[model samples]
Target chain A: MVKEQIKPMTSRERVLAGLRREPVDRTPVCNPTSVATVELMDLVDAHFPEANRNPEMMARLAATGYTEIGFDSIMPVFSIIQESSALGCKMQWEQKDNWPTVRMREPIWRDVEDVVIPNDFLTHPDTACVIECIKILKKEYGDDVAIIGKTMGPWTLGYHCFGVEPFLLMSLDDPGKTKLALERMKEATIQFGMAQIEAGADALTVPDHATGDLVSGEYYDRYLKDMHAEFVDLLPVPLILHICGRTVDRMNSIAETGIAAFHFDSKNKPQESMDIIEDRISLVGNINNPETLYAKGPDAVRDEVCANLDAGVHMVGPECAIPLQTAIENLTAIPNAVKEWHSRRESH
Target chain B: MADLQDISNEKIRQEIEEFVENPDEIERNIETFARVRPLMQEIAAALIEGDDGTVDALTKQALEDKIDALEIMDDGLIAAMGVVGIKFRDNYIFVPEVLACARAMKAGMAYIEPILSASGVEPLATVIMGMVKGDLHDIGKNLCIMMLRGSGFNVVDLGVDTSDDEFIDAVEEHSAPILGMSALLTTTMPNMGKTIEAFIDADMRDDVKIMVGGAPVTQEFADDMGADAYGKDALECVAVAKGFLSVQA
Candidate 1:
């Protein structure tokens, strides 16, 4: 059978096409998570603690994903703690080489009734920087590349707001209250997602840490499935859901969420994840960040990239955020391998 | 095959039937379950189901019913956690389920600990556990602590973001023979190695066995850092602790 040859797409077009499950010239290297590293930060003089706060530095560091590494998408929101920081959780804004984290020991809210999205939530420096950064990327790239924005899901917000032990314990001790808390917290997700969309983000990465290691597939169905479907309807842009660890157990439920795609972790096999999604939604990744991208060389990175391509992953990127110390060569090899694999496929 | 009716306890029989209906491919430590008495099996089944209230009640009833504290621990809590460990490793269950099981195990342990300690019977081993410096994630370490305690080890938990000196001081204070470190981020994984180097510099390298685990840790990384062992999950953490104890013996 003769397959039709498609024309190459612009970075924005390529990523959108891949998300829509349409044909592309090659697989788009889309990192819905951060690819910012210590080396890249030094290259652009945009380090964390500041990049996390300043829009100019955030956009500059994120642009390296496209300009330096040749990925089709640029993700500016590096830390998951931005929304939490704005919500009043104590944040440890680490050095250039470290990831900023929320101090879970100091939880801000005790009950679902206490959950309140401050009037200044959108105008907060940390949250506003993401919107402003997306605006800057749109000005510079202007439809040439896809600018991806992130909004922490309610489950992640629960971790930041109530602390991990208290939240999980609440989920186990009293599911009704947990649902109410997630229901109330979801408003924050929708507001931030809409703000980024208005700020010119083409897509949104919704990272809810219902990681397979921490939460069960049943919990995904019970708590998050409806909310995720709601996000697709409420948010204007395409939504990519990201979860870490072996999530094959919940892939079936995730497929029914009406999301545009799922950014999977390396703990899951690429072929298995592809099969589970069954083309219902695009699968963006299953790359090993710690092993292949951080510890091993480019050759190992190429092998994983090829594996995802062969598995028919809609886009290729790291499993989660790449380690801050990950080499530039390993990050560059992702797009290079995608191009080479497409060329080889075409030749055959 | 044993008859379901002949198994005596309905809950234990139901649990076995459930496993029989959908069997896991991983080889379980069935010897522990097989050696458990019928009452202990019921306790084990409740623990596996994560019925903490039931575990708490059953453990108390067993103690009052004249069951040996050590017998109830080995035959009930530890045995149940063994099934959970394999289920988790093989992906039959996940973190929420495991946490439930660990909580139930703790419910059972609360009644057993004081009794076992008062009898002057030695613990399986004294171990120190913590999250490496700069890493705040401790869910994995907490799970390991639960499993270690269930398996009869006395663990000194140093909590999250523990510095090298904190780890060294914990081991010294407890006079612990084993140390287990956890880190969720690759950025902080080197802290495990740094903690090991600190031990060496303090001339305490040979005094304690070091083990490392977490999402980012691999056997190769553990070996590179000169760790005595690497556990892939909470169940493996218990096994590694036992291996250290056997070597010391």
Candidate 2:
């Protein structure tokens, strides 16, 4: 294998190089979702539901990804609810230990016509929190660590605003109406996405839960592909598109969308995922969240990291969002494993 | 095997074909119906078709006509649900389809509950179920509850964010043989272990067998948490619940 003898890169340079699928000194560790842990919350004095709403707390907690754990990028938006909350959906911002969820059971919008991008969508405290968090991270760690921001995709926004059942039923019962809803909803994606970019995010992790089990490959082709491709033009930043669950079926369709990378889940095997995308876009993630990281020790965590690096995934990190109570040593094992694997290769 | 396409009642067959997507699963569903009485076949077909009103009406009329409620439940709702479970497990169908089937089964079970209770026809087992503390996700948990009920287990659902004491309290109150915990988020999964430790602390761990499941849960995690059983989906949850009953028996 031809290896680069380039000088060592900063975490920011490595991440941006990874996004561009360029050669870096080593593979950059980028978690397009989150890596927040309760232990980290205690260390940084940034706790959830509040960290999700407070820009400084959010930035402090997010910086632990780079500052404490040595991830190549610092992702400030830990939760998926910021856009949903700002859009007027009711929220269940649970205790400090739990994830703040949208009250999706009580959907805010029933029809496309009922949907409104309130003038305050961006400036609303929840939305502003994310923008402000990115700005703070950029100000503090701008030159050293990649500040990756997150924006919810229209499909996920559809689930929050219309509720999961009604939205899935809509997709099944009326394709035209679902398309209309997605088209109307895509604006929100571009809106928050551009807002974060303007706030100085090196790239964006747009989590659209068009997940594998609920939606199909054909569904991706029909509903999300063009919109994602359109996002490439609109967001004007390298997008690490994230969809959870076993998503091997849609990787081919996703590769055609012009996004920079696919932030995939552990449910997908790293080797099979790499083969599916055919290197059309950068691939990141595959470390298991629940079993390998949360439940097991660092050895198990290192094994998964090594597997993803071996599969030639461009960047590596937890597949979905970090489970909040996951142990600290398990989190650090991610970058530790990545560096070890590359070092062994260099020795050869 | 003669083709499932050979079955009469194109209405029921078409419904089965639409909702039961895999060819092998479609054949199995046809055989489940073909082997049962015509009335039971009608009920099973209605359940698969997710026509809760039809299941409700058919169940009510069958009981009025003196058809054994057990036959209607076993031959009808449970049999149909087995197919729904298979389709969902196999990824040939998804949440919407399974939910419709669950509601259809619930509609049928509504009639069976009173008859079984009044006749002293004991349920499969009383099972305590809940989402672990700090995890509000319940789509998978709700689906498992419906499946357990369809399979004749009387389940007491504690809803989401259930504290550890609540799980022990439910088990003791109901004298249940099985307890199932679910958590969709990885962060909240440790609560399953914490709840198990709570049972051990209360000195009631021996009273009820524990089973854990959810989206991110796996057999290895379940074992690590010291759970007696782990189910990947709602279908498997029923099997695990039954397995727990046999272990107690």
Q: What is the TM-score of each candidate against the true structure?
A: 0.93, 0.91
| Displacement of the residue A88 alpha carbon in candidate 1, Å | 1.5
lDDT of 2 by residue, A30-98 (tens): 798897888999999989778889999999999999888899999988889998999999998987788
Docking class of 1: medium
Q: What would the per-residue lDDT of candidate 1 be over residues B147-169, giving only the tens digit for each residue?
A: 88877788899988898999999
Flag clash pairs in model 1. none
Runs in model 1 lying further than 4 Å from the true structure: A1-5, B1-7, B20-39, B64-68, B247-249
What shift in Å separates residue B225 of candidate 1 from its native position after superposition? 2.0
Q: For residue B65, what is the lDDT in candidate 2?
A: 92
Estimate the lDDT of model 2. Answer: 0.87
